[model samples]
Target: MKITGYTDRLSVQPGENIKFMVNSHYKTYKAEIVRLIHGDSNPEGPGVKMEKVNADVNKEYNGRRQEIHMGSYIKFDAHPLFATVDSFSLQAMIYPTTPELGTQGILTKWSPAANTGYGLFIDDKGCLALWIGDEKGNVEKISTNQPLIAGCWYFVGGSFDKKSGKIAIFQEAVISKTNGKFSLPYEAEKQNVSNERKVNIQPFADNNAPFLIASVIEKQPDGKHKVINRYNGKIDRPRVACAALSKEEMSAWIDQPSGKDLIAAWDFSAGITKKGFKEIEKIHDISPNKIHGVAVNHPTRAVTGYNWTSEEQNFVHAPEQYGAIHFHDDDMTDAKWDVDFEWKVPDDLKSGVYAAHVHCGDDADHITFFVRPKKGQPTAKTALIIPTASYLAYANNRFQDIPLAQLMFGRAPVVQQEDMYLGEHAEYGLSTYDHHNDGTGVCFSSSLRPILNMRPKYRHNLSPSLWQFNADLHLVDWLTEKGFEFDVITDQDLHFEGAELLNQYKVAITGSHPEYYSGPMLDAVEDFQAQGGRFMYMGSNGFYWVVTFDPENPSLMEVRKNYGNQGWKSKPGEIHLSLTGEQGSIWKHRGRAPQKICGVGYMAEGFEVSSYYRRTEESGAPELAWIFEGIAKDEKLGDFGLVGGGAAGLELDIYDEELGTPSHAVILASSEGHTSVYMPVAEELYFNIPGLSGEENPRVRADMVFYHTPNGGAVFSTASIAYCGSLSHNNYDNNISRLTENVLKNFLLDQPLPGAEKQQVLTKN
Candidate 1:
């Protein structure tokens, strides 16, 4: 028997000795023939195709062969038929064609004995056939029968298996055992594959039969099927191994070839568990001389950790490993990359600072390490500062309370005894706070920042000046002791001109919680940069509201709420902020500056920092070598581990690591660290602001980070109050100090860098 077309509407042509086979492969197959019926004038006119003979399908097979007799009755059923042209509706008819014997094919329903049933008969020509339901209601004879579908070939096959109740179809050419009985071969090592293979039945007889593709089939109310891709259910030939062995037999050999390796081999065979086993560690000892290192590149995935080899480009793998497995290696054991970046620092190399960054080929994760000289002790310079208004003392014009005042001034600021849990503030109205409670108090003045009105009063029995706000200022004294000239300016001196002093220094900063700000204080720093300046912002919740300062009423500026009164329309207080569609609502119209600004914006979906993108060593930033001195080799751009719901460290929000633009900012660190709130990163530019444009007009250019003007006017911001003290604790103070010294001596004091021969260091101590 020879197999012809295997399609939705399949068929087999007639030939005496040739047998037709049908089974799982032929479940949707059928056969038919078209004989032109003559009109009044001619014999070859347009007419319907007639079915000479057709075969019936019995059951699904596991490759085992089953046969049917040459003249056996073949039922033509269930396969849908469609009209090729508008001429007529396509029809099927048995030999000695008749409109009787129930023309439209029989509707097979749920049968208890079998998943599906079959019916067939033979023609006087010895051609195998069966009746399609009776068209004229004559069900007795085989001579009058109609075909069910068209576009198919048909012939007779051997008798079906009585016990197993199946019919097998041949994929390849095979001689028939009987005149019409054809044999089929079971699935074998034929393809040399070792994974799972699948086969399904059609008209599947709705008996809770499992689907071939997925695990389960959820039946819809309308009697249709929806396969549950996840769970498992009753499936036909569910999961057969590449070896065609059952589950028990396959599991027995798991330890030998390794479960994962074996699963990879049989992946294409049948559907199994979604999570496959991973291969054990395999270490290959290659000659150190023959290869510098290895490099594995995934075109589809991020290629990471390939900086220790020469010619680290990648090519497709050999056929053996192609699509052989489905899994994500935990520690990246399955793939190793080695590229010759030579990743080593020279022993005698001039020392300053260094950083090493690493990334995963799949863009999985990034880590960085900072390396500095161990010999020279760094003086306090770089400072991290935090500015808050949670501490402010005022009286309510009450009776004499001198004794209470003296006691409160001795220790820390006193917490309030009364809770204002009235009305909208009733959430924690009954909450009591002492010095040990570390909670805020409540005041009724709308003039102060919101936090100050909520500070506790009774707890400050020690030193009133040693409160939260004062504690941060005291940290400035400690940094100064370490030779760092850093100071934490409170809201008392929250002025723009105060920050513009950075032009005389360098590396001014901001942070995670300096929620209250003045417009002039913001503008003074921008002006300082109009000359030449550098700034750094490592905070969140930077700028979202507009604080109004009426010069005529000095100290009476309006601190607008998030989005006017009831918070922003988007996420209320935290996420919504006005936008100029450029940098951020915080700095956008803050005056004129010379740089295309891009940094972390004010407000966060939450305090949590999200993983975005990363930059590999391939990103050419030679200057970064000087900035991030002691970091790991394979790191990339990401968060810095200081982000979450209540973290104080607001990381850089906007950064294009790959672009490496001098104007383009590197706001966030190269890993999940801090969530940046206010980040100012830019070079310098010149522009004219229109005076009539309100916050839009300006004339002059300036830097976004630091200030640099020809008239010795500059600004120096050392971050928020708490950050200033935190930097001293970490020696970042020293870096900032040196940078300050450099700026003063070179730009403000009109001195050249150390390499210059004649210029004097005007700002040196």
Candidate 2:
């Protein structure tokens, strides 16, 4: 816990350079390259097994503590127009989500150190306030009598007249049936304050200071500008004018900006398409000077603006109605740390999972990364696709803290040391499963920060067992023990390179939980299968959510949770992703069910204990007998495992013909004997009722399936998230290991599978 870090890249090829950024309390730390084979620390399983690799980066180095600054705002570079403004007016449409969280800046060019310039802000009392400071260190402020309400939109403006020494402030609520928390008759009682005051001091304009929206620049003791007074809410159509406009003119400017004195009018809906905003960082300014701005730290865009009506739900259909940009005080996309060291992968280095093992005194950390086969070159016939996207989705997730977590798991939550650190250090950022400070669901996750939960030997608090990254390592250790030559690839690589990356290998294997997937990643897998590349879906609940990477920054992933079983739901009219304009939610809602490609779909889940698979009657068919060559007819497959004491515990899937499972697909085995704790997934139920647990529901089970595709290709699925956790059982001597080995070995062969001909005939029929 004392030392932690992350890599610039999740997966690299031979001859590629990867950088590591560390934050350590100690003066120095030891570093070494270790190939991770197994990461589960459970004594019952193969304990954390990592092989030391002789690499050039293995050495002790001095360490420095790095700090992460968290906040989302729009920034414009210092321009000449900002410095020449003596009598000016500022107008913006504001929707404050957390107005009572102390003073927050809406628009400012003020310097906290010198106390100079003019600005508009939400005062400590949550009222609309105008502030002016002079070169003599004198400050004057005027605020509205009534406080602004949260979850409501307001048109706020302020103007300072140098000739008359008069300052006027306006705040009026804009309410619609679905635009705000309250509407109709309630708007009459809402706070609508307009005040005018006389000030003797002239405003000091600091042209050197950069203009910022939703935040103010505070000069630190070191003379560095640090963003402070971050506002948590939405700001739409902010306009600035060099002339001091009257209260009525200010209102007109807020509605439509058109005047000779207009300095800048920012249009939040610019560049937005029906497909979504690809270049999300650029904020276009519709002004003669073209003083544009850029959003720092990704803010939620394509949100409902003040003029939004309930008629249109998607922003692409009505961009003018969706001009709001939601800024959160806690939003963070990157740690922006200085690289401590960089290591260029040697050409001869083998493809696998590797990490920089760093330790100082008793505190240690492992910055993990995947080394894939050399670009466009394959050294192995098999490939292991690590679920990096899923890892990011749950990065630093506070699962145990979620309501009813203990009840869902059917036991007390087990909190680990890493989880304790994550709870206290929120600057590390929130996951897709977490909610922001203002209660909105987090839609974006980035890998630039240290992910405590993605480390080696880390266990999920909810499962109280190895999950995701660590759980996938169980298969890695098994492949090593069995002496199979295979390469490793990550979700990022798959998403970027597409199906061409998988074509280099004969067999492709998924990790223990590939739940989060982008459209291209799924297409690549399907294309690979169609091109005669065999696929092994070793995990359950895969290809579930629809996720997309920021085209500008691949490390950042975006997902809007709606429908299906979710931690939090996206707000109405905001379900479409801002990065791709694609509707965000489960892929099944888009008609691409997991069964359509992987031959299985999520059915039920439980964490108390795992059940065992029972061989089906179809396993005895002569064409499929080879799949069970090492097992007996009465034997229980994966009856014992490190996860939930068996392989079918965490989450289960089934071969549902109704959901696009191939008609030729055969259910070779099905699990049974699950506890009442396991319940059917929400997507399967049309109505909420009782008798939905595994004890009474027929759909609560894992089904091992096999089927063939076009061009001599094939697909195999072990529909359980805990399947890989059982691979290390009995020192890899168990039936589960034997079954997986038989399938994988056969899958790796150059020729077609045993039942390919029969499957082809079935498909033709």
Candidate 3:
């Protein structure tokens, strides 16, 4: 009950055994975790040994150090072992058995050797023995035969009535089962009266003796009970029946049925006719069909099934022998029909779909099923529905796809220009959509309004008529070469409900100058990609602003910018507007960054682009030589504008270098001139910054990145938009022609085209 070194008070019920958990010093002998009891105390009558409470000498130390004889001021070194809340109730109760000596030395006495055993005896034979404390301490013994036995155990329990002596002891002997079954108790067990053995009727005499506890195995640290006689010269008796029960016995007591608390064991309906059946409410089919009869096989190795349907079902199948799900009758076996033997689709199932059928018997009538080899899958089929605006220009056309006209002319409030011609005096062109036609029509004039107003901030240089035409042309050519298909309608061309479009197309393609998009168009594409659709950008300043168009109004889309509209922060007219916010933003608005977003913003760095390095065997250039099948390794990365420092004709330049790409994505090629941009908020800001933030900016790493859907459909992107139109603008067939063919074949056409050869792994010392 006495506590020390703890702030929290301990509590226990009446009659509960008290345990003092103390942190004491260690002595000469390596201290083992122990449980102690006073076995022998000095100068008393017959003394009992002090048993070890709990000690562990298992800890490895340098040496035993030194040893000391009895009473030589033992300095036991100790460490504090923190006690948990549950450790308080772990100590066992103690019963004293020391002072019942009868001067006969039969009931309690010291050993003749003076430093040895005290134990229990039966039929003039020692049955159990115990020693505690130091060699100089006293020992106790019990030399009576009634309670001690050689090969038998006596279980003492209670029977409240006194007629049969109130206390009952069943002397049941242990017997082992010869067969692998339960061991039954031995018969002919004896029962004896308490008065059979003569002991003076001293009702208050202490007869409990100390028991020695040590590990049954000499090498291990364990505890056992050894009973010792306190009276008979410390007769050593290392015997006490083991009372430990198996887990089943403890569970029986814990889960036994009770009458007072009578919880119905038969809570379930005994049968369908049971009154307890509360109209078994219709159970909905919550389990998916893919998991219906599936048995897990090698759960670690992911095999594609229903979960991988999106990645174009390109996952590898199991070996023929292990292919459990057999759809054909030729391969069906008794094992195949066994529902107990269905293959377990791994949680990490690869991206693809799997199908298998089983016919229980040799009849045509059978069950057919399918599994998508993916974990989380869309309920709807994945497909791509090209928007009406894109349909006009491309429509699978390589020569004259009208991606620009499809985007602009299809909407209301058509753009207008003056009717004018270049080259000759007689040449003239018609100004179709303009309200007031002037002599300025038919001139190829580029304005900075669209670029400036489309900025996410700074609205001063705003102009309605920006270089929309140029943006349109670039998008159209890029789309055509990439082989994207589209519908050719003005406004009401392409629209759908929910995330349906994403399920069809693996990727949704857009343009740089997609500065204007109707609300519905934006929502559709956003939902599409969010549902796992891949998206590619070919033009600059795409998804720049927010516009709402009403068919009822019959006017141009209402362009909202500044801090006025609800979505002004994302509106295109605000200047440098972005398409996406964060990584997963529905729009994922990003923008031009001469220094931050794009390494090269505005027209400043456009003029400095020049090709440097050529293909070299050491650089793994020849490995991708197939990508340039008709070109040599010595060729430049690409040929575009001449090397200069002034305002270049193009906004982006392509060269050769290395850039990091996502594991799931591929880097087809890279360029050195392309700089990297810095945008700390690109992750949290949920928007792309436009224009150069400052001179201290990171350069863009020009790379042609490729991303494929789970089903193997893909989208490709180049660092620069200048290569949008010409396959060989400067008689440079290697760069433009090779890239265009690769993009078109792999992405839009879904062709089984050749890819770069795997690079060899080199080991260095």
Candidate 4:
């Protein structure tokens, strides 16, 4: 809890440099590099096995506490036009989600330290207000009598006339059946407000201060400007004019945002192609001055704007209706912390999962990162693809807070120290599962900040078991115990380099719970299989959700969840991702179910306890008998494990021929006896009815499947996230371990499989 850090990247090839940014409460901390073989701290398991590595960065160093500045806004350099302006008007289409929270600045060019300049804001009373300050610290403020309603679009404008010492502020609701929370039958009294007043003081214009939208700037003690009073909601088509425009002129400008009096007219829909936003961060200014701005942090874009009519749901087809940018006060893309140490991996270093271990006194933390083989220089015949994308999606997730945590887990949640810290310190950022302060779903997640849950020995509060990162280490430990030399790569590498990266190895294994997959990542794996590469899907709930990374920053991932077994749903008409302009949600909705690639798709999930797999008739077939060679046909497999006491718990998948499971695929084993807490996924149900729990539903179970692919390749899928957790049972001598080893060993051989000749004969007939 005292010393924590994160790497700039999730994976780096040998000979490439990677940096670590650390924050410490103590004066100094010791740093060492260790290869993580096993991370589960359960007494019944190996107990956190890590091998120390002699790296150049292993030394003690002075530590400094780093702070995270969290918020999203748009900023542009102070132009000469802003410095000379004596009388001006500012207007924008605003949708205030938390107008009553406090005073929120909509548009400003003011310096809080000097208290000088002009600004428009939502006052603490939730009313439209205009503010102007003089050089002597004197200020004039005017507020409307009526408070604005939340979740409704309003044309908000403020203006000042220096010559007459007059100020005016107005708000008008622009609501339709599909545009806002209320429709025509709703009362209009709280939707409109207007006010005008005369003041004696003239406004002071600061030339050095940057113009900002959705937030104000305050000078910190370090003489740097920091974002403050951030507005939470959406802002569309903000414009500035040199003259004191009236309510009518401001309304006209919303339709035609260009004129001689215009100083700056930011068109939020500019640079949008039929695909998606071309320059996502760049805000285009249409006026002659070209005072453009850039978005700070990653705000939700390509969202429904004030004028969206529900006629066109896709932003790519109607960008004009999707010009708004949703800004959240808690939005954070990067920590931007100073680097504490850097390490250039040696060319001969092994490819595996490694972490920078930092400790001061009894407090300690580990910053994990993956090391891949050098470019065009693979050192092993097998590779393990770390599910980095899934880790980011669930990073810093507050699962303990879920209302159904107890009901779903069938017990009270087990809160850890890391979980408590995340509840208190929210500056690090929210995960995709969390909603923002304004109650909108968070669609984007970044890895550039500290992720406490991604560390070794961390357990999820819901299941109180090893989840993504540490759960994957179970396979790493088993592979090492079996003396199998395998290289390590990540989802990031697979996404960028595609099939070429997987082609370097004969067999590829996936991490436990590769639930999120980008289109390119799926393509690469499929392409590898088509090219005679064997695959071992060692986990469950994989290749379910569709995700895409920011082209500019691969560490940032985006997902728009709508229909699925998810925590939150995207707003209406905003189900498509802005990064790739592709539909977001479960891959099955896009016609690429996981069953098509791995012969298994997510079916149900439970957290209370794990069951075991039962051998099916297919397992006794001569063509598939080798998979269960060492185990009796009647013996239960994976009956015990560190995860929920068995391997077939957690999330389970099934082989469904109706959902694209290959005709030749064989269901070697199927699990049974799940508790009633295990329920079918929402996507599988057409109606909300009873008898959907595991006790009644026939589909809530995991299936172990094997199928041959093109050329000499094949796929072996164990459809449960807890499968790997059972590998260390009985000191890695259990039936689950034997079954996995048999497939992996045969998968590594260059010769044809045991049943290849029989399969060929059947195909010829």
Candidate 1, superposed: residue stretches over 4 Å from native: 1-482, 490-507, 550-555, 561-600, 608-620, 634-652, 656-668, 671-765
Candidate 2 segments whose C-alpha is farther than 4 A from its true place: 187-189
- Worst lDDT 10-window in candidate 4: 756-765
| Models, CA RMSD each | 34.5, 1.4, 37.1, 1.3
- The best-first sequence of candidates by TM-score reads 4, 2, 3, 1
**Least well predicted 10-residue stretch by lDDT in candidate 3:** 84-93
Stretches of candidate 3 exceeding 4 Å from the true structure? 1-467, 474-509, 516-536, 551-555, 562-628, 631-635, 641-663, 670-696, 700-702, 728-734, 748-765
Runs off by more than 4 Å, candidate 4: 760-765
Per-residue lDDT of candidate 2, residues 1-765 (tens digit):
879999997888899999999999999999999999889999998798889999898999999888777889999887878888889999999999998888899999887777888899999998989888898768998898678888999989998999999998988888888888887747445588789989998778863567899998776665555678999999999999998997788778765778799999999999897679858999999877788999988999978898888798888999999889999998998888889999999999999999999999889998999999887888999999999999999998988778798898899888999889888888899999998889898898999999988888898886758788988998899999999999999988899899999999999999988999999999999999999999999989999999999877989999998888889998888898899888889999999999998999999989788888999998889988778887999999988998888888789999989899998899999999998999988888899898889999878999999998898788999999889888988878989999998888888888888879877887788
Write candidate 1's Cα lDDT for 1-765 as tens digits: 111111110111121111222222222322221111110111121111111211222122222112111100111122111100111100111111111222211111122223232222323332223222122222222322222111111211111222332222111111222211122322322311111111122222233333122112335555543322111100011111112233233334322223321211121111111211111111111112111111111001111111112122111211111111111101010111111122222333221111111111221100111122122222222323334322211211111123343232222233333212111222111111111011111111112111212221121222211123323332333333444443233332335235433333443444334444545455644554454444444333343333433232222222222221111121111111111011112333443211222232321121122232233343235433333334443443222111121112222222222322122232212222222221222221133222311122111111112222223333322222222222222233333333333433333233422222211122221
Candidate 3 lDDT, 43-83, residue by residue in tens: 21112211222222223222211111100000111111110
The digit string of per-residue lDDT tens for model 4 on 687-731 reads: 979888999988999999998887788999999999999999998
Please give the CA lDDT of all the candidate structures.
0.23, 0.89, 0.24, 0.89
Cα error of candidate 4 at position 100, Å: 1.3
With candidate 3 superimposed using the best TM-score fit, by how many Å does residue 54's alpha carbon deviate from the native? 99
